[model samples]
Target: MPLKTVNVGLIQQACGADRNTNLAESINGIRELAEHGAELIVLPELHAHSYFCQLEDPTSFNLAEPIPGPTTDALGAIARELGVVIVASVFERRAAGLYHNTAVVLERDGHIAGTYRKMHIPDHPGYYEKYHFTPGDLGFTPIDTSVGRLGVLASWDQWFPEAARLMALAGADLLLYPTAIGWNPDDEEEERQRQWEAWIIAQRAHAIANGIPVVVCNRVGSEDDPSGQTPGISFWGTSFIVGPQGEWLGTASAEEPATLVAEVDLSRSEEVRQAWPYLRDRRIDAYAGLLKRYLDR
Candidate 1:
């Protein structure tokens, strides 16, 4: 079969308190990438505002909005104008007290393609997402678009191999992560480096295991904590694109705002999977243990 290539772009941006400014920066990045022939563009997680999950105040919930609300309206307009598929993350306000970390996909014609709420919610010192977002109800499913089937997941979801595997089994062509992960400012340099390396390795391992390309977009720069109890988080922005063979196609800077476009050959996954054949030899019957929390004797 012939090569099925899609030019993918990732925007690595630093958000501030001003939502307008942050959204404008994302829009500029999208326009720039579209001009350079990017058919599909992805933004970082919660790109519209600062990382406000640092505190568990009820006021922070005001930042959440409906899915077809303002942010998507603006991004959809751009996607329609440029005729490119755009994957964006949003803090979805489902109801009065229900919220979710949702990843929204816009088709080329400016329509809502699909959405994937982040299933895994992390609660740590600097990153306190569980306090803000409810667990995602949508199962591991891929959003269909003109380019291909995109398995879009949020920051915490990237760490789970089961999530990636389920998406691959459901006919996903590429696994995309809209991430907002970073290091604690108080941690030692060595520890920080280990964390960063582990993050990258885990995602790349998912690619190698599933025989699908992995695209991740992360934020850059530091955002202060509201309570001032801790130093704050310094988002290490090493956004990257890797092939089905876990080979780096392109990578952005570790501490700067960047726009990267890489041509992903969708057809290559078939060849890689055929040679590796990891999926073919799987023992599905014995995998019931995975469903349980743990194998306690």
Candidate 2:
């Protein structure tokens, strides 16, 4: 039986140039968190290498690897050794020319639990993900693990309420986001602060609306752009966990690599839902127009 109260670990760390070094850093963090009583550990998105979506280059595809290849094998071993569940994000090489931003969930026994492919692909100045990854076809489905049912969404997918609601309706116990979002070098400090605040507020809203806890593990440190066309992005770490009522359980530093572990009482969701009842108040019958791309006036 699953425990009523679970401890989750967020590994917010800097990515190194070498894939092996980055993997080793994440592994060390996971081991430490497991030793400190974390039953479920999560790493930031694409933790195997630096954020390479700054520019559109076909050569970047070489970084993508098969899901069950080297990355999963290494993380699986750690999960098995530590007897803890691990959620890891990776750039997946699905086929000869196909790729995806996929999150793999590993059970305590080192077996593959399930995978969540990132549905939303962002295409901005610093994030040119559309050039690399194809939009995930897996849909918004939750993955079952020893800890609980994990509704794993990639970074860009966090911005959509529809995605979160779908996961919640599917009976996900917790919402998890393995993220790699950061500040654009040219943005003003004021704007950067607001952007970060919005990101946190949005996720908190999801927690309150769904009556489930939310976990976000983000990357930290600055990675330079190899092509020199633009200043590199400085990733704001700030990994956090929130309760069912949107109360913060714990948060990491915004500028440092840190491991944050927090105990969450999963049963509290029932109490919060009884008082707030956002899910029960939702008008599921009146959302037919949501299927359209736009309802122009």
Give the C-alpha miss distance for residue 297 in model 1, angstroms.
Answer: 1.5
lDDT per residue as tens, model 2, 11-32: 9999977999999999999989
Q: Tell me the whole-model lDDT of each prediction, alpha carbons only.
A: 0.96, 0.94
Give the top-scoring candidate (lDDT): 1
TM-score of each: 0.99, 0.98
Candidate 1 local lDDT, residue 263: 99
Q: In model 1, which runs have C-alpha deviations exceeding 4 angstroms?
A: none
Model 1 TM-score relative to the real fold: 0.99
Task: Return the lDDT, model 1, position 36.
Answer: 95
- Local accuracy of candidate 1 as per-residue lDDT tens digits, 1-297: 899999999999999999999999999999999999999999999999999998788998999999899999999999999999999999999999999999999999999999999999999887788999999999999999999999998899999999999999999999999999998899999999999999999999999999999999999999999899999899999999999999999999999999999999999999999999999999998999999999999
